[model samples]
Target: MREWLGWLDHIESVEDSLNNIKARIKAFADNGGYPESFAIIYNGEIAGTVGFNDVNKFNRIGVVGYWLGEKFQGNGIMTKAFESLIEYGFRELGLNRIEVSAAIDNKKSRALPEKLGFTQEGERRQAEWLYDRFVDHAFYGLLAEEWHSDNRED
Candidate 1:
């Protein structure tokens, strides 16, 4: 996790994890769920989380972010979770565009958006500083029209 999540690099105790959860909850409340997050539960345990961040209601855009536990990988959990999240983003949240980015080297992470029919927008050079070094990100985007057209039932 530390290899991908830089914030975990400094978490030395359980309290730090709890504090982070607290902060996420507070942010959800304070922002009226603009940055809504959901836990990915598998076998009654939290596999990970998926969320929308940097939401702009006026612009009808948001960024999707997610992480899955190692054990939860390859189980199709994140894909299903993303399917639901994207549905909600388009149908309920009324978003026109939803973007996602993954570290360019992280193939597993990058595969999700690609598999879900998101268009490869571009690359963000040195988009994130992960502890010791910087990491580039490959950006992907899905617009409401695109998603709807691709997902429509015949």
Candidate 2:
């Protein structure tokens, strides 16, 4: 996890990783607290993580966040991972909406939501604080109906 600091500015130490694991466990058990995180595997090797963040059960909404290792990117893996996640969110979790946001400058990360048919809503200025400075984020949203329309099998 330390090696991913370049792209994952949120992780700073071993303690952070341990704490994150604990939080993920708690989230999975609690069902509505923190984001439920999962390890993304590629060919049986750990590749990254994709999860539903800020889940609001009452509103049936959640935010999506993910990170992929540099070597694991560019193969349409994350896009497919997110596609399946969105389907699960709506079909199994009964969520009505899911949102994603990326730093405006992080074009690669920002592209996944767009590729998944998430509508570009707008930008949130300085919505995130990286290691050194604050960065603006571009927010995107997708409705369950929109997803079903695009992805449902006949």
Prediction RMSDs, each to the true structure = 2.1, 3.1
Q: What number of backbone clashes does candidate 1 have, counting pairs of residues 3 or more apart or in separate chains?
A: 0
Per TM-score, the best of the predicted structures is 1
Tens-digit lDDT track for model 1 on 56-110? Answer: 8899998998899999899899999999999888887889999998899989888
Error of 1 at 27 (Å): 3.4
RMSD of 2: 3.1
Alpha-carbon local distance difference test for all models: 0.88, 0.82
Model 2 — which ten-residue stretch has the worst lDDT? 1-10
Off by over 4 Å in 1: 31-35
Q: Tell me how far the alpha carbon of residue 18 in candidate 1 is from the true structure, in angstroms, after superposition.
A: 3.1
Candidate 2 accuracy as TM-score? 0.87
